[model samples]
Target: MRVTIFILLVFIPLTSFSALRFKEVFYFSERSNFSDSHYRNQRPPYYFPGNFAKEQRVEPKRWGEGEAELMEEALSELLSLPQLQKMFLFLARKGPVALKRFAEYPGRVPGGLGRMNQGDKKIGSVKMWAAEQPSFYVGVTDDFFKYMGHLDREKQVKVAKYIGLHELSHLYDYRMRFSFRDQQFLRATGWKWAWFLRRWENQYVPEEKRRALMKKVEEGEMSLRDLDRIVREQYGLPSFYSVTNPKETFAEVLAAYVLVPEAKDFLRPEIMDFLDGILNN
Candidate 1:
């Protein structure tokens, strides 16, 4: 989560009045691959691995060998979900993202379960970050998977699928540049859809407060404390982590909406309607 805050702090526009540009190509790198000495010798900006000489921008990459097959199999199963299928189709106008699975996500960046970059030439079915130092996207942690070998087959599949749904929801969040849904999420704060154009911070919090929260989390080692406060205050959000921010709220709820039978009651009609509009469009 802190890493996300740092990235935002660096990337935040100088003026709210200035125009913003959206990058269409989203990039993913396996943390292990990026750390490999041979790969690093030829790494592109932001650890993208393809040869940039052919194109000014390093061409995006996809999972290779056994990893590719694993992701394809998992995604094939995941798309069996109706809402997930529609959502990916809407996001991946050009194509599906090149899925690069890391045995463990890298420590350099703060996304708890995943990290994603956005650019828009559609890579195919589109698919698609947190704090203390800032992690987001709840998923199967390294510890969970390491010990997963012991679980019964049925329980193992259940946990893995739940994690996948959470990760997918985050991808959906990245693709939504502007939505009446987000505007509604922001409520009558007098903010508009355009405000979300390049801003990745929570849409609901003021800039100063958001930064302080991020810092407090990192410095105090109190990531869970903030969550406890939110639940204690009773924001009525569907998931405890969803209380982190609007982006997380949508992602967490979307995951629960798809996977948790009880999560259905927590969602509003407009949120689903907005999602439906994206799926159909």
Candidate 2:
């Protein structure tokens, strides 16, 4: 009896570990192949006069003779503005590399490529320093200007400026919450779990339903198991992955706070109420 019990324990752990290894290998292979194809069509990485560059090589005047000059001027002015300056400084103190990158190339507008890898061309995505060094990278998808072709040149510039500030705010939040070690762990674990959880949450209950569920959990009327059941049956998320981790949840909360001030009603009321409850408690 004793020997059977020991064998079962050892066999189970070994089997689980091997499965995890296989999954990791599969994920890495798929991601690496995707990335190779994605970069194949990219530009050779040249430094333009202004910090921003479009993925395609246009005559640099497709917009007009003075468009590039205007963009640079606008970016310089925005950088010096008090609000932008404070936000940049906050990120810089946390990670110097991201600060330098932003200072050097504050905006990137990819051209002609209807969509970037992760998102459509209408909006751009930014990547901040991961607790490491001196530079940050922000990618602006072509979508930022898709419908704005009819808008005046000045309006386009203003839209870019606002979007840039929003991305910069994300950088600040990242630098504050994650340390070098924490970042390393996250990278090793991969973002698939987080992506999966987010999708699952959006599937069944809709974001609108999460607040009530969270409320129940907080009130002790619903146990963690109950929350897990709702997430699984209603949302179609794997129970283990959905409830076992809190990193993504914390980051989302922090990011929302940074982007939308508490005094404002920029976000949905339910989301704001849920976050507020977490914060106050």
Candidate 3:
């Protein structure tokens, strides 16, 4: 019985949602089975930023699950906060959540992300959002932290929290509106910070090299081992995933903005203003 349950847990975490369903997709791992003791006494690196309740210490509620389940539930609770909720409401008002997609492809091999520093297509929501209607998904393999080299439970929570922050940044890329008949979708220029990231990518990465990078990404060639190289070599970006594209850069910055301690080192002065603008804008 224990063996059967284990196998089910291993393979059943991924529940697919068809593209045409227009319903949100949610796929999360049941990795960690941690208790309140794990984070109840711990402090959140930074306060979740917002106009109201601006300094609240935000952390995931305790659960009797593995590392993966903690990340999944933590994300839900984090997004439920009014601070984050308000932001999502604003985006929903603008684009409206008609046929909006939300899926999770968590890393589950237990050892590594065989190919791609990120994913076979793109890391996180960027790839799905890059689609015709800007569908989005947050991609994480178990090897992510192992590769980014973050296995600590608390740090893992921060990773999950930031994934939410980053993916929402991608959601804002499209304009969702309701027409007389049904709804209309249009492409819009992303945030100013995203544009800045593009310029940075262009300036730092030569055309040929940039093209090569794209090829590698399309081929899922980047690996966890490559994280150190990108982190050490990136031009002021927060994480290697940040270098993937403007959306990723924007999302990563968003993640870093609300972080503290281990992940807080990546924040910059301008990012403070950027974060404020995002919260208030």
Candidate 4:
């Protein structure tokens, strides 16, 4: 079956605003061959192949009964925002993004995963896998439903949209090669890249404070997670995972600024302003 996708562009002119507003319309058929198919034989601890161009073309997996509908709703809501729409279009310009599902893949996480294979776009007349096409593989495991069991349909959709936006934010950051301005902005929150160590380091706290925490952890006075949490909390990061690296911090903050209603209070004003400049400009 062919993959089906439809987009409706609505232009609304505002008296006060010079730019027009647009709403994204997405429709995905149940028979769409968009889901990933490389994991049929793979078992637990699935490893996503970094490059998608070399994978064999197998029958793509179909979504569970209601999964497609949920994803369609989620995508429509997510692209309604101008920032997200811009991001999607920017990536599409490099190469069309393929949406795939991870169907009950053992040990699969219950969220969206976005990856980009960066390479050349074309060799003569043929488009190459070297093109920077971003792919999104969404997984909705039983744990996802159990966690959202209490929320109504509308709320559940919101949660799904939030997760989708989070993953898209990652792709956007990747496509931009993690902008230097963004890196500088987040540096204030205590995330830094160590050239010598060749990894991200948490410098949010003072050296003295971190040393003290290390001593406590060594003495069994505090757990390592606790030490990390303390530094993350000092900057009011959205979650502990956000502090994993500057890229994650960018994704987490951007997602919150766009979807979370109370994000203005939770995130620092400077961070929100930075996102506004990037998305709007």
Candidate with best TM-score: 4
Q: What digit string (tens of lDDT, one per residue) describes model 3 on residues 189-281? A: 122223544543333444466556555644558644354246524544455555554555556665555553454454444454555655666
Q: What tens-digit string does per-residue lDDT give for candidate 1 at 1-281? A: 45544444456656632211111212334433333344455645433323223322222344445544443444555666655656655545633443443333323333321221111111111122211111112222233333322322311234445555556666666656332355654552223334555554433444465456555544655443444345324433443345455666666556656766654454555555555665455
> Which has the better TM-score: candidate 1, or candidate 3?
1
lDDT of 1 at 147: 32
Tens-digit per-residue lDDT, 21-93, candidate 4: 2222222322223233445445433343544322333232555678666556556666666666567667556
If scored against the real structure, what TM-score would every candidate get? 0.47, 0.31, 0.42, 0.57
Candidate 2 weakest ten by summed lDDT: 25-34
Cα lDDT, model 4, residue 31:
26
Candidate 2's TM-score: 0.31
Sort by TM-score, top down from the best: 4, 1, 3, 2
Q: lDDT by residue for model 2 over 1-281, one digit each (tens)? A: 45554444344433421111211111111111112343444454423234435442311112334433443443444455533344444544543321112211123543222112111222343322121111233322234333322322311234444444444444554564431224432332222233655542332344445666656655668655555445434433322122223344333333434333331233334444544543343
Question: Model 4 scores what on Cα lDDT?
Answer: 0.50
lDDT of each: 0.42, 0.35, 0.40, 0.50
lDDT: the better of candidates 1 and 3: 1
